[model samples]
Target: MAFLPTSYEEMKQAGLDSVDFVYICGDAYVDHPSFGCAIITRTLEAFGYTCAILAQPDWNKDEEFLQFGEPRLGFLISAGNIDSMVNHYSVNRRRRDKDNYSDQGIMGKRPDRATIVYSQVVRRLFPHANILIGGIEASLRRLAHYDYWDDAVRRSILIDSQADLLMFGMGENTIIEVADALNSGMKIQDLVYIRGTAWKTKSLDSIFDDYIVLPSYEEVKTDKYAYAKSFMIQHENQDAIQSKMLIEPYDGWYVVVNQPPLPLSQEEMDFTYSLPYERTFHPKYTYIPAIEEVQFSITSNRGCFGNCAFCAITSHQGRIISTRSVESVVEEAKTITKMKNFKGYIHDIGGPSANFSRPACDKQREYGACAKRECLWPRKCPNMKVDHSHYVEMLDAVRELPGIKKVFIRSGIRYDYLMYDQDDTMFDRLVQYHVSGQLKVAPEHVSAEVLDKMGKPRKELYFKFVDKFYQKNKQFNKNQFLVPYLMSSHPGSTLKDAIELACYLKKIHHTPKQVQDFYPTPGTLATCMYYTEMDPRTKKPVYVAKTYHEKLEQRVLMQYSYPKNYALVKKALIKAGREDLIGNGPKCLIKTYPPRMVSKKKSSKKHIDK
Candidate 1:
């Protein structure tokens, strides 16, 4: 099918007087399945509903929001693929100059909180219209939690936006149920009890008896300990088979969070990705930077099991790993090879956690992921099924396709999981062909204490993985490097820990071009630690580098090679009481004096070192 209506003219061209749903988005419209707006709108279209796109509407103009008029079913809203605040600002709370998801890499097209902003405009223009909010922003912020940008705990987006309902997690099936219910003449408020959704009511009298009551907005707002305790409960009950209905008390009403929907099967995945996508950005736009890389890429799976404390995939997409069939993936590959700009390359292959193409174990379906345990954390579970043979076979199939030169896995494959698998063939193949110079992996920190707090394995695992990576490179006669994505100032990381990381990086003769300071956005466990200053799991006090000065000090140590960061590094070294690291010695992190520079004089000195 052609791209969904992006303009009023297109809606009329499609012979529709009014669309069933008009999707307001924070991103420029792209019809690829990787984008949530595309999938949700397309899913609605597949169900015989006419859907139109109001992509990145000017939040200040009510007229722009009313281009498609009021919808027959309801208006669906999403903060694009990423949260808007994260899209518009940096971890340091600085406004970003460019937006990769915007048209021609521009910023400021959307507001600070695009989901809530867009919803307000929709409500103003269409007073009686039904509004449904979804996507990562709404999903993660559905409960009252920490907001890093605001530097405070903010109530649920549902309360702030005043939307009719909030859809959490991947909402393909639940959305269909919602639409069908509304289509059957049910009011939005009465359309409760749907899984993977949250709605507000004045009282809990109508709520089913089996539900877990979280700390009230009033208590959690005033008490950090209460918020931490509440997060642990929300974290544990995410499983489909085991989750209890969650209800949180706000001012006058209660926000009822239903149990998460079960994961989509392989067949559902195939059907979803098989939808006729334009496979690129909307035609009206001349360019969209996000498409250039993913245009040729294919996602083979959905959901993640990595359970990184800093990542929200578990809370938003769940921990169950579900994959599309190899045949479906191969077909997508063939289709890409025939595209207008086919370049004989497929950029990436996996989802939330790449290399995870199946559930952690066979029993995951009947019995939910062990409520209290992880599949590959603390130590690899003996019952955990680990193999890369299916991925290897799929890669082989794609690479064997006609007109295919390289099938790179740009989306990161978890290094820990790769090491857990006993087989070495996939590793060898990856080093030999899939890598495009460097393979990326997130070993967030090197300190054992910090790694433990991040829910990641210690330095020993990263060292082992690095050793094996280089060994495979040597065996395959490939010179590909390992690019480790590192983080700074995660809850437990101290100036001492950051210095230790810098020393390790120096020993390895590597300096990263970029470093991520822990961003405490909504529902992640790491965010809980950042906000509460306590580990939610044990409710034990944990040290946190909360001050911007301290966080900058930690970040400076990571990139000490830069001349601009030299002063900060020296200050950090001095402040952390590691004066031993300030001399002109191999063990020293920085010199006592700046490098000499020649003074520009009209008289004599040509190149005097300063």
Candidate 2:
């Protein structure tokens, strides 16, 4: 199948004078099903709507937004698959030199806060064009959120972008309804009834008969407690079955986010994947680095139930798990084998969480995920269902397929879920065939208090999983290693907690090459905690490493085994009143001597006076 027209000349070459919708994306145009723009535009095209793309327009050049002229239905904007700020800057807020979404791994193709910038570009050039924003950037920032790059709370992106509508979350169903509504002559404001959409309006009196109102934007910005209170409401109401259309007042106007749509059914997932995707970036551009890893991989499912406080999966994809049938996955595997680049290996066959091939439990479909309780946090509920047999069966089928030498699951596996299952068949086979010498799993931190605040199960579960993993490897006569992903300075992580984790890593003889400092992005429970210094769930005080220096200290402490971090690690130990950890004992985290520090106590008269 031919790819969607990306230029005015191509649009005319396709015998269309005017396109219905012009989609603007910050990413290099890849026609793969995994990309959001591909799915939304293809779904629209399936319904017989004309569409074109304007990928990564130069924000400084307002004329760039005028490509494809003006669409009949208006403009669709996305900040690519990732938030632009996250893409442009590293966790330390340093400007990154390479962007995988750009051609040849170059940076600066998309402007900062790309959705808002692109929206502003469209609004400036074509004042009447309906601007609809979606994708991860708009999904998470649909409401007032903490901006880590700016270090302040900001209003909903709809307010800043002046976009007519925002489709939050996975937009397959939502975009279709939106297109139908707009196609049926419904005005932008009149499309309010569509679930999984948000809009800015001066009055909400006309919208809902029964709705939940969050604290005003001013209150959330000024009062951390108010922010926490409002976020708690947003989190509980995100489910499609039980969710309510929510409204938050923003000065004279309101930013109303409609209820999220239901997770795509198995049949629907299969159809979307079955679409005629060119399955690669447009041929005009060559050598895109982003598609390299996923070009041969398969996505078997969507949504994540793990709901780690730091993850965006819950906010964007929601907690429900839905999967394509095994036949569908196997069909895709056969297709992969036919590709010229086929190396007899499938890079990955997984989703947001690799092992989450089904809903958390049988009750999820009928009753919805429990609003008050998480399925697998604090403790796995007695009624919760745990099985990985189907997943194992799928892997076995793929492995047995002709011309398929090996299939690896690089997408992260939920170790906690693995430990909960009684049967070890899936675990055994995963070690035997899928692992590529190492398996990557996130433990985040080893401190119980830190993991508790992270919405992770107890540290004991991770330790148990590690032991079992090694045992399984031994049984299989394999030598796969576990690469634990650890994080630092999440809310409730104290210097003492960092020290505790350092000690634990030392005991395990596993010092991570790099430790990720907690990045307080929009729409995460941990971000709420990061901004407010309190858990939204309990509104209890949490010790967040707020200052940049404190964040650095915590990061360095996680890699305390490194020589470069010796000074910082020693300083942190002394500051935490655990100078005992700096001595030359087996338990000591750092060596006995300080590094070239002339004692300030002996250098200054003020120190003597004190």
lDDT agreement with native, every candidate: 0.88, 0.87
lDDT digits (tens) for residues 1-100 of candidate 2: 8999988888889998889999999999998877888998999998889899898878888666776788888799999988999999988899999999
Tens digit per residue, CA lDDT, model 1, 1-610: 7898998999999888998889999999999988999988888888888899999988887778878889998999998989999998889889999999999999888898889988888888888999999999999999998998888889999999989999999989988999999999999989887999999999887765599999999999889999998999999998877899999998788999999988998898898888888899988887999888788989988778778899998998888888888899999998899898997989988787769987898899788888899887887788889878778888999999999999999888788888987888878888988999878888888898899888888778878988999888889898778778889999999889999999887777677777888998888999999999999999999999998898989998988866678889988888889989888899887788865544553352221000
Output the number of the TM-score-best candidate: 1
Task: Report the CA-based lDDT of candidate 2 relative to the real structure.
Answer: 0.87
Give the runs in model 2 whose Cα sits over 4 Å from its true position: 593-610
Residue 83, candidate 2: C-alpha displacement in angstroms: 0.4
Runs of candidate 1 with Cα error greater than 4 angstroms are: 597-610
Error of 1 at 374 (Å): 1.5
Worst 10 residues of 1 by lDDT: 601-610
Question: Would you estimate the TM-scores of all the predictions?
Answer: 0.96, 0.95
RMSD of each: 4.0, 6.1
lDDT at 607, model 1: 16
